[model samples]
Target: MRSHLLNDTTAEQYRRSVTEGVERVAAKIAATERPFTGVTVDALAPRIDGIDLDQPLYDTTAVLDELEEVYFRDAIYFHHPRYLAHLNCPVVIPAVLGEAVLSAVNSSLDTWDQSAGGTLIERKLIDWTTARIGLGPAADGVFTSGGTQSNLQALLLAREEAKPGRDGLEGPASLARLRIFASEVSHFSVKKSAKLLGLGEDAVVSVPVDTDKRMQTLALARELERCVTAGLIPMAVVATAGTTDFGSIDPLPEIAELCERYGTWMHVDAAYGCGLLASVRHRDRIDGIERADSVTVDYHKSFFQPVSSSAVLVRDAATLRHATYHAEYLNPRRMVQERIPNQVDKSLQTTRRFDALKLWMTLRTMGADGIGRLFDEVCDLAAEGWRLLAADPRFDVVVEPSLSTLVFRCIPAAVTDPAEIDRANLYARKALFASGDAVVAGTKVGARQYLKFTLLNPETTTDDIAAVLDLIAGHAEQYLGESLDRAS
Candidate 1:
């Protein structure tokens, strides 16, 4: 009689809480970024650890204060323009809001009852991505944790589809003799997926790359022929749309042709580059992606969404049936009669978050062209970086900027010894971090170490690159002189 469900929050209460929290975070982010001093974490660690951390453990306000402290102060703000490390970048406002809303609802997408509207929303998103990728109207796919899981799911299906008489074979042994072909520049996930699928990493044939870093189509064809002649089942061809090390896009049209000729499943891992589909200029780069048996796309990468928003898109909806398993309670015998395509049947996970909402909201708010333009802007910035380095004799740009990645080494004309040059570049990155000049990622290509920059933040400009270059050059001079002095 005394309002038994008072504890249950009303919609108005939920809305106000979300609105207040978002406004506060937005103001904090804006205010926090006001000072543009270029110092890295290594320089600030001593000062950062001096902050207080105790009192009012039971109070909600205190808890929120603590959350803000950890979130703002200690956290390496990826949204900061200087954060060019790895592939992490600034997520957009709309997507961030979507993340907040979804987190508040805490919807579990595992079953329809658990998330009725969310299930439909995610399905619609999958359908939209599928059609955009040129899969026929009947194609289907599901969200995964990231590109790694998407790659794994694609390969799992490939193994099942490729196995001779696998439709009836019930054991792992039946999947033997299955092989996959990918480029040396391909992400390590393919090798990991092979090992996890029981096919062994040896099963993934490493194809050679051309001067441009693209997977050699001719080499792939030869490997496929050899695989057939050897009587091994050609399971799948994993073509990379944007490789991790160089951001090189493989020749998809030629690869797709081979897949057709040899009847092998073609899975395109466009994890970093699939967003190019939105751009009029770069869309033609992935000309034959339409023919892929499956595709992997990371919304978190190019869509400006928060993490854990990745997908595996299959050419045919029926291929997902290969991963089907039935449970009585969740996917009941009686419910099967209703013909609700249980997403759980196609996924590798049982408990899934409503990740598609973030992407869905982003696309709805900005439209496909807006997202495409964002990709174009970043790619243009990368091209600008490439041009900047190409004109500078002090630097050695290893590869042409691909998509949003810039790979170059800080080797001035004064340095001759390869060993010493390598040492200079290594210390320069550390010095850059130590000095808080900029946050940059480094990788080795062949025999030399090169600093890499991934430009996913649309707000970043050529001026940012100029500042980082200035820092790198300054650090290089200091490091190189010390190396020479030490040797002398």
Candidate 2:
């Protein structure tokens, strides 16, 4: 057991163990034919539950052998090109190498002393990201767990800054009257943040969106005026850069103007569209992102990093004080005067993983353009997919993708009932997932069932999209035919 530790005494053991594990994973990747094995919860649960907690495998090889049967065999492989369900991207090789290195070193980024060079690395990455967004010289940010946490932190700052006379009403006493205006299609995290911050139940005002699925600036203006008239504190206006379902981006320049007039914090949830920042060709899609007071960026979603890499950036570095706290034992008050950089002072998290190293390694290994070109490829593929969906009579695509996602549903030629069509689309998605050839996602759009393809894998070609569409059509047609037979 002592030999298993990762210190200098067991360095050889660690090397051999890690190498063997990597080799096994490489072999598994080579052998995998599809994105998944279609293993059900019932089949996998018992196997996981049967493992005795007290029992130790003693040998790494034996554990690896067991993993092949219980874990790796049924694991959903996001790296596969056809695993087009959500925002998960096939990670880049350089970032994967960074994951390995950072895991071994195990640097905690909360305090500078704990992660000396790691802190600098993360800070530089944050600075680089702010520069890309054109957030100005005073911009600052801290890496977080993911987009949800980032959104929470951003809104938390907005809540704290809503003092009396700044946005109307008293500070903490007016919590119930504090309202956040956001587009109806905005991420659910905005509402969740409002609840977490102890705002009223009706704090989040859902403003309507335009035909493009973007936020309606006129409606937002009316809502802001209403809030002011009603004597409520309009603390924040969240503008989405990329909606989860439609990938629609709200009109940012207009929303920024509204935020200025209303004296409210402007937050842009660019969890998906942040990739466009790196995209040389598609950068204009999120043109007004710089106008946001604060922004959320998820590197894992589109930057091709691994899980647990995201950040919340604020234009005014002083705004980060809302999240700061000074403990005598850790980030002491005196340390602020010592000019020592402590990431925890601006982070919601206390003990944070060095997730930024992954991005740093990625940037150093392959310049930003390398990552940008890969993202460009995926966006191009999504455009091709959208075109294909438009020409095919079996599918009705929603709004054209502003990013790399297409939401559509299979429509049978003879089906008249909308409920039956919804069932067909739902069945098609589930059937495709069960067969293990491809995986897609389904969501409701204005009371109709629709399927979504989040194209993040550059390797996924137009033909792959065509093939998957045909599969969905076949499954839906089969379901509809079975329904007709039952009715007759």
Top TM-score model: 2
Output the worst ten-in-a-row residue range by lDDT, candidate 1: 1-10
Which residue pairs clash within candidate 2? none
Residue 236 alpha-carbon offset, candidate 2, angstroms:
0.7
- Ten contiguous residues with the weakest lDDT in model 2: 164-173
Task: List the global CA lDDT of all models.
Answer: 0.83, 0.92
Instruction: Please give me the total number of clashing residue pairs in predicted model 1.
Output: 3
Model 1 Cα lDDT, one tens digit per residue, 320-380:
8777777988887566689775678889998898999999888889998988988888888
True lDDT of residue 104, candidate 1: 73
Taking the tens digit of each residue's C-alpha lDDT, what string does model 2 give over 387-451? 99999999999988898899999999998899999999999999999999999998989999999
TM-score of each: 0.91, 0.98
CA RMSD of all predictions: 3.5, 1.1
